[model samples]
Target: MRFYIQQFIRTIMMAVFAVFFLRLHVTGELARYVNPKYDGMSQLAAVIFVFLTFIQFSRIWKSKKDNQAHCSKECSHHHGDDHSFLKKVISYVILIFPLLTGFSLPPQTLNSSLAENKGTLLSEGQSLDIVQESDDHQYFPAVENTDKNHNEKPLPNNNYLQEEAYQKKMKTLEDVHSIDMNEDIFSSYYEVIRASPRDFVGKNITLQGFIYREEGLHSNQLVISRFLITHCIADASVIGLLTEFEQASSYEKDTWMEIEGTLDVTTHNGAELPIIKAKRGRVIKEPSNPYIYPVLRKMTD
Candidate 1:
């Protein structure tokens, strides 16, 4: 009887990877890690790992005749059998550590701390290229808001919108006197308003997000922010509107809220941007999916 111990360990590692990825999808935790649009890719990875695990399993058991033939001096082939003991231990530990962490620790939502770390409040036009593309760009002719949330085709909540559909969403938004920043178009629409704050002056608006505050914000002002995840949580960046209300200071950072207000011009570090002059607000529980992903595709890419 003969057994390839290294092959057995490799098989187990491959199986672990397959199961770990499957667990994330089965438990609905995958969305917390990546955009739903790429779920097919991750599921594919899991399938490949499963296939590799089976292939490695076949290598773990061989008859004495096969083992002897395989290990003969004339047939010498490196398959990790010559790895130094210390090298093997260190390499396995390095890999197993992250897998252990993934299983033992729950995934976390991106918080305002990440926003503060990036040194971007998303209020400035210059830093937005990191998380959002130009939505309205400088100046697009506006369309009348005949009906809010009405479109020739309803915008899919997926990661990309067709060019025509995207333009329609932005065009309708610009001409509207009031807006509700829904999750479907949050990131794209936000960049447009940030790009052309003057066009949206005095327009009533409603939005919801966790509270974010920084040093220079007035006592009446605090940011209502959401982390915008482009590819995955690792690439998340904070985006939101500056909001001012009489009782803004009563809410602590990271408190979830929904607020109604009107858009008005504000200067941040000498650049003009939109700020919500909050008329009324109510505290709300945090959303299950708190991240805002970019909605439109960059057809240019």
Candidate 2:
């Protein structure tokens, strides 16, 4: 009887897990806790949960029909060695508490308070080459009516090699100069700014994040920050850029805001850091999906 009861409980727990994942994915709350790249994996796990529940239910049904038949001497001996009542109760509590909480409370994004606790990663300064190249490559106007003596000495023997090198250089230059802080590339912009703060100096940027102020920050200094989660909320880390605004004190901590500014390099605690000198700022509602997923390759590397 106890075995059948335990199997029934296990089946219900599996169903709960499956339902939790489905609800998170359907409501789009999964992104708040984990990177979207892993959404497929979560769905796969949910399917597995449903499959296990089916297997558990089959076992429970089989046990019920054969209760008397399976009561052989060996079965009796094994059942006598079942886990203690206290241990069984503890296991059930461990499985049910999280499911209950997930159902009862609303999902939340990591905010400024959690940012302070996790600590921010925005202090290093590295040199970056900011070379700009025209995207359009048009052939230089062919020399017209040039003197024979100055005629472009039939193209060099390594002309193809030189052309390839030039194209490669132009591609690199284009990448270095491009910095977009829109929703699609917010995390990429953050990575570039963190990796090489000096390269972005004087570039205009617009982004939204909660205000975070740490001890020792000047009255005018605050951070515009967001949480970066690769796997799940448990592993979330704070990434932000420092900002200086005269009226920073007017904005309460943890308030979401959209800020437009120019990137500037500044010194803080003897380390050069990227600071956004805000030109305009305004309060904004928090986004439904607040956590930013760092470029996966960069995060793994």
Judging by lDDT against the true structure, name the best candidate: 1
Candidate 2 per-residue C-alpha lDDT over 138-248 given as tens digits, one digit per residue, 9 for 90 to 100 = 112222233443333322111112444444443543365434454444565676576677877777777778888877677766888887776788998887788776678
**What's the lDDT of the predicted structure labeled candidate 1?**
0.77
Angstrom error at residue 288, model 2: 1.0
Cα lDDT, all candidates = 0.77, 0.68
TM-score for candidate 2, residues paired by index: 0.74
Best by TM-score: 1
Report the alpha-carbon TM-score of model 1 versus the true structure.
Answer: 0.83
Clashes of 2: 0
Task: Return the clash pairs for model 2, or none.
Answer: none
Candidate 1 regions exceeding 4 Å error are: 70-80, 122-157, 298-301
